[model samples]
Target chain A: MKILVCVSKSPDTTSKIAFTDGNTKFDEAGVQWIINPYDEWYALVRAIELKEKDPATVIHLVTVGLPDCDPIIRKALALGGDEAIRVNTDSSDSYYIAAQIAEVAKKGAYDLIFTGKETIDYNGSSIGGMVAELVDAPYVSLATLFELNGTTASITREIEGGEEVCEVSLPVVVSCQKGISEQRIPNMRGIMAARTKPLQVVEPASIETLTSIVNYELPPAKAGVKLVSPDNVAELVRLLHEEAKAI
Target chain B: MSVLIFVDQTEGHIKKASFEALTYGAKVADQLGTTAEALVLGTVNDDLAALGKYGVKKVHQVANETLNHVDTQLYAKVIAEAVTASGANVVVFSHNQTGKAVSARVAARLKAGIVAGASSLPDTSNGFVVRKPVFSGKAYANVSINSPIKVISLNPNSYKTVAGEGTAEVVALNVAVDASKIKITAVNKVVGEVPLTEADIVVSGGRGLKGPENWGVLLDLAKELHAATACSRPVGDAHWRPHHEHVGQTGVQVAPNLYIALGISGAIQHLAGVNRSKVIVVINKDPEAPFFKAADYGIVGDLFEVVPKLTEEIRKMKASA
Candidate 1:
């Protein structure tokens, strides 16, 4: 089996967000980044698990970003990806990014393509479907449970009120979330091995971005908490009912 | 060309977020000088025309019993067909679980540019630009989709739903359901509880509650508020709570109207999941707990005393009223 898993970089959850150039660019001056948890923990880890189950399976990691994304690609490699491909481009447009991935998938004839259910940064979850559409393949998203059997794959996804289980064939694309697999930690040996693994960079195909960021703003600041004495519990109830009106 | 809204339903009743989508679609239609229409895949028990209060002029019902349950591919195919048949230039969906599952597929089938997690209505005044939350609600992105057909999945609770006195025309849409390529073998449901995704208010607990035995304190508070219950990832990882009830970056991301965190030290991942909530109340014994930074209200007291007292107060408020 030939599988391709997509990964991206996201700011560490605790990173304080700030923008530069009059709030037009994300301030990365003192921010720490990590491989998006969904991509690394769920999609890529599940693919690695599949490879572990079958020795003949080959797993490839892919990402579309500027050269700064190399470290994240290396992290995926250390996590058990056999090879890495970086599509050199700005991931500003969902369709454009999906097109680049579709191009790679078409050329490689990968049997399965995986992406995080959505990027933590953009939260779009748009690329996988567009890629599936561009490549004329079936798309299964938000898959929590997956099992591979010969040529058929049983996938379980979360719906509104319940879970829906389905079966599909290979050559399909999936956007996975939690419950697909437990996150794996790369060992010291794997980290050393990743340094030797090959990572190929391909120039991006020119595609137009349908969307652009015109501006960036933060949520309005919340008011200071109304601290009531523990003895004054009645006032707290009154405040919740009349002022907050949350109940 | 009109704006088409997908009114997601369960057991023949429309989901609350779908009403918000209807309002959003209708407002978008008004922006473009077009009409807004809604399409439901299966038969619903509610009076469909009553949805006109949200500004929708018409409701299109597929009336298929088979579609009562969600089939992502099937719904995408059906909605794509409905978009074509209705001459809709824009398709709107609430970016809830249903929208997350199927909207992109519909966008793919139509080759439409989709912007999910939209926080506001489009600015069609300048070629259809929409603003949405990004970076896990830390920043906003103003995206423009220059497509003949546009798909947008509005984030739940982002757009306030307005109801007006109006009536809609109910019409039946005709479409053939394709034989599903994938078969559904079973459906495991979380019954008799408010789903975390759709809850208006959420009351969550953490390891500070001591153990699973003390979960009743949080559950009691949750019941008093008519809110769903959730837990931090540590509580879930330790099996103190079910995984579905877990809310964090690794768990479910929710944006309820009010989120009350009891005994949870606010981690960034947990905040990312619930920060989009309209109002947040944090109760913890530790004044230095990180969750207080993000909370709109904070009570530095033992939850063992605070939780029961709060629940009792709510119960008293209910009795007096």
Candidate 2:
């Protein structure tokens, strides 16, 4: 089995969000960049698990970003991937990123494609579907468990109120979320092996983006909590009715 | 110009997000001085024309066995064709899994400006700018669609589904659909009394409920309210609830009408998921719980005491009604 796992560089989840340049762009200053947690924790680990199950299987790491992202790509290689491919360009937009990934998948003819349900940064959850569309394949998001047999893959996902089991043919796209697998850390041996793995760089495919980010801003500061006397339970109800009007 | 809404369905029935999209599309159609129409793919046994109660004037069905399952590429192609055939300037989607998949594909195919996770109707007073949650529900961004054909994917539960009086005219479209690229091997459903996404009311518990054994109170309240049950990430990680029921930054993002949180401190990640809920009620013993800051109503008491009382009161009211 050949599995392609998509990863991206995003600001760490704990980064203090701030904007610069007249509030038109996110300021990356003093922010720690890390592999998106969803991709790192679920997609990568799941790929490694699949590879572990089949030692001959190839797990390739793909990312759409500048050369600076290579360290994380190499780290992924160290984790378990047999090879890595970096589309050497800043991600243009979701479509552009999907197109670049699709370009690689088309040439490589991967049997299965894996990506995080949504990047922790953009949280668009669109790329997996977009790539599936670009490649004219089936797409499933938030797959909690996935297994492969012959030319088909069986996946179980939570949908609405129930768990939904779905099967899709090979060359399909899946976005991984939590519960897919426990998070894995790269050990010294895995990290050292990643240094020797194949790291290929390719140019991005030509594509036009349908949308662009105008700017980003932080959420409003939450108001301090209102503490009502524990004995004044009725007063709490009165405040909810009168002040909050939420009851 | 008309607005065409894609009504996504599963198991021969309409998805809840589709209704929310229908309502959103209808309101947008009203805003654009046009009527809303629907294009339903696959096989649905429901009354197609009766969807007019949600403000659709006509229902277009393209029932092919191939379409019983969704193929994003094929669906996008057909919808783009429908938008052209119907002369729809505005297209709306539900931004759910289906909507997230197909909307961008349709937009790319048509070169239309696309906005996903739209929380409200466009500000048509000026140019077409739609407000959507950005930074994972932490902020809002108003994006302007410059393309002639504007696509908007409404965030689920962001808009109210208002019922009105009308019947739709069902028209079967003669579009040719290709063979499905995907196959459904098996559908293992986790049967539950309530679906978390479709639930009007959701009751979520966190680690503060102490252990999984103490979750009886939550189940009692959820059962009384006919509400879906959810848990925080920690609780799910601790095996207090199924991982599927975990709703937070790393879990499901839901927007229900009423969200009741018990024994959960409002972490930023958890808040990111449920901030879109219309109403939040927190029941926590801790007076300093951060969730109360965002809650519209909060009860300062132990869940063991408050939840049963609330459930009993609700049950009494239900019995009387």
Writing each residue's lDDT as its tens digit, candidate 2 over A1-247 gives 8999999988766677777887667778998888887888888899888888888888888999998898888878877888889998884367678888989999989999999888766667777877877777777777889887877888876554455677777878888998888877889999888788889998877776655656555656656445554454556545644576533
DockQ of each: 0.60, 0.40
What local lDDT does model 2 show for residue A201? 90
Worst 10 residues of 2 chain B by lDDT: B312-321
Predicted candidate 1 versus true structure: per-residue lDDT over B95-178, tens digit per residue: 987787678778867878888889888987778889998888777888888778989999998888899999999999999987
Q: What does the i-RMS of model 1 come to?
A: 1.8
Over all chains combined, what TM-score does candidate 2 have? Answer: 0.91
Q: How many residue pairs clash in each candidate?
A: 0, 3
True contacts kept of 2: 0.39
Model 2, B12-111: lDDT tens digits are: 9998889889988999999889999999988889999889999999998888767876667789889988898899999988887678778877876776
